[model samples]
Target: MRIAIVNPNTTQSMTQAAAASAGSAARSDTVLIEVTASTGVASVESHVDEAWGALSVVTEIERCEASAERPDAYVVACFGDTGVSAAREAAAGPVVGMTEAALMTASLVAHRFAVITMPKRTLRQSEQVVRNLGLEHRCTVLAVDETVAELAEGSLHLLDLFTAEGRLALDAYDAEAIVLGCAGLADLVGPLQAALGVPVIEGVAAAVTIAEGLVAQSLTTSRALTWARSSSPSEAVSA
Candidate 1:
């Protein structure tokens, strides 16, 4: 199976980081394609960036059109899951957002979860997304006192910083699992899990698993559904 790991950021490093994490767990036959948004925020950290970055989600699908085989799944590798609904609408395969996938997986593992985001401005967005997805009943949003760019800048030591923050989010909040609310932190889940003694879910890894599971079940967004097609054109970017 082929999977597209679309990073909704212009940063190549961030795109590569997401691809690496997802690729590690992908099936041997799964071709994990990595691509960055052609135009958008360098890193998604705030509501403004989330809204703007959401627009660039279709960039990868547009680019992949030239290829002989389209990817079996499209993964929006930002924690906000900016344009997941639209991507699903536009694609023949499944389009899963990292945040949505992580939350779904977290729900299956634990009764409650605390999402650890990068910036304070993102906490509201995270909460809004959880509510929008009907997971607010089981999740709370938390923010790290740092930005995603800061994490990438000192990536060599990110594991330590993330573990410390993830532990605090879990124990302090009494959360059963901690969702990594930034795609850039996908690689730190194992360390964070060890440190917190709870599941630390990352969007990249979560999205891939969800996509594969959907494929296994031969599932895709229904074209006949009113809500899927009745969305306004202005709201349509990709699904």
Candidate 2:
């Protein structure tokens, strides 16, 4: 199976990091195609950044669709799952979002999951994701000491901060699982999970795994409901 991994941020390093993690988790026969957004913020930090990054992600999806070797599934690498609905509509195959995959993966292993994210600005967006997934009762959103941009730059100090916050979520909030709330923090999943002694869901890896399942099952997002085409059939063709 072929899978397309779209990194919504403009930074190629972030795309590389996402690809590395996804590659490690994916099956040996699965072919992975990684694409970085050509235009957007270096890192998606706020809702506004997510909004702008979405357009770039959609563009990449279109490009993938028109490619000679199109993917059987698509994975939006952003923790926010930016542009996922749009991409699902445009593609013929399944599209998986990082946030949804992580939360779903967490739910299977633990009843209560807490997200450990960056600074304060992105907390509400993560909360919105929980609410959208109907996981508000099962999940909590928390932040670490670093900003989104800082983590993308590979800050060593923030790893400890994330571990500390993960501990708090486990001990204080009584969380049974932790979801890493930023794609930038994907590399720290193993260490954090080991230290906390609980399941740690990294969005990128989770999304890749979910995408693989959907592809194997020959399933894609249902266009008959939430993602139904907005334009008329004729209008869609004319455009």
Candidate 3:
């Protein structure tokens, strides 16, 4: 099966890191198609950035669909699950978002989970994502004093910050699991998990496994209602 991992941001390094994380969880027979959005902000941090990122996601999926190696499924590798709905509407395959996949995976392993993301500004957005997914009661969103660019640098000091935050989540919030809230933090899962001694869920890996499962079960996005593609203005007029 072929899976396309779409990094909504234009950052090539982040895309590569996310794809590598996804690759670690994928089956040997599964092929991963990596796509970095051709036009979007350097990193998706704000709502405006998310909007642009989402557009890039739809564009990439449409481009992929027109290619010879159309993927069997797609993973939107943004922690906010940016452009997921648009991607779903544009693709014929199952679309998985990092936030939803990671939160859901965390829920399965532990009853209460806390999401650790960066920049602090996206804390509300992360909270809303959990609420939108109906997991608000089971999850908490925590932020660190760091930006996506800082996280991308993959510094050992950033790992220390994450470890400290994870400890806070576990001790104060009674969180049983910790969810990495950004795709850029994919590579830190092992070290963070080791430091926290609890389940540390990375959305890229979780999403890959979920996408693979969906494909193996022969399940694709349901085009019956909400995700159904609407006719274009011209087509609608003709009809």
Candidate 4:
């Protein structure tokens, strides 16, 4: 199966990092295609960025669907799961978002999960994902005074800040799992997991794994009702 990992931001470095993590978790037979948005912000750290990023991501998905060799599934390489619904509507296969992937993965492994992400500005977006999943009671969203760019730069101070906040979340929320709240945080999963002595869920990894599993099971997004097309029958069938 072929999986397209699309970064909503224009940063090729971030796309590379996300692709590396997704590639590591994918099976040998699965082909991974990585793409960075042609037009969007350098990084997505706030609601405004997310709004613009989602548009670019949807365009990328539509571009892929227009390709001669379309991917079997598409994974949005942003922690916020930006443009997931639109991608699904525009594609013939599954569309996976990092945030949803991470949260669902954590929910399966732990009774309670805590998210460690950026400060108040973007915290609500992540929190809403938890609530929308009906896992609000079992999940806690905590913020760090850091940006996606800062984390992606591999700053030790940012790592330290994350680790400190992670520990606090474990104690305060009594969480059994720690979900990294940004795709930029994927590289820190191993060390953070080791340091916290619990399962640390990284969205990119979780999204790829879940995408692979769903593909292997021959499962695509259901177009039954929720994603039912509003267009004509011919257009809907083609979509």
Best by TM-score: 3
- lDDT tens per residue, model 3, 156-200: 558988898899999999999999988878768888888889989
Candidate 2: lDDT over CA atoms?
A: 0.85
List runs of model 1 lying over 4 Å from the truth.
153-161, 226-239
Clashes of 1: 5
Q: What is the C-alpha lDDT of each candidate?
A: 0.79, 0.85, 0.88, 0.85
Report the C-alpha lDDT of model 1 over 25-73, residue by residue, as the tens digit.
7787888988789888888887678776877886566557447988888
Per-residue lDDT of 90 in model 4: 76
Q: Which candidate would rank higher by TM-score, 2 or 3?
A: 3
Models 1 onward score TM values of 0.88, 0.94, 0.95, 0.93
Query: Per-residue lDDT of 37-102 in model 4, one digit per residue for the tens?
Result: 999899887888989998898889888988999999989988768888777877788889999999
- Cα lDDT of candidate 4 equals 0.85
Q: Which 10 residues in a row give candidate 4 its minimum summed lDDT?
A: 227-236
Candidate ordering by TM-score (highest first):
3, 2, 4, 1
Query: Which stretches of candidate 2 lie above 4 Å from their native place?
Result: 230-239
Per-residue lDDT tens digits for candidate 2, residues 1-239, read 99988999898888888888898899999999989998888988887888988888888888898899998999998877888888877788899999999999999999998998777788887888899999998898998746677766664557788888888898888899999988867678778878889988888899999899888887888878888646533457999
lDDT score at residue 81, model 1, on the 0-100 scale: 80
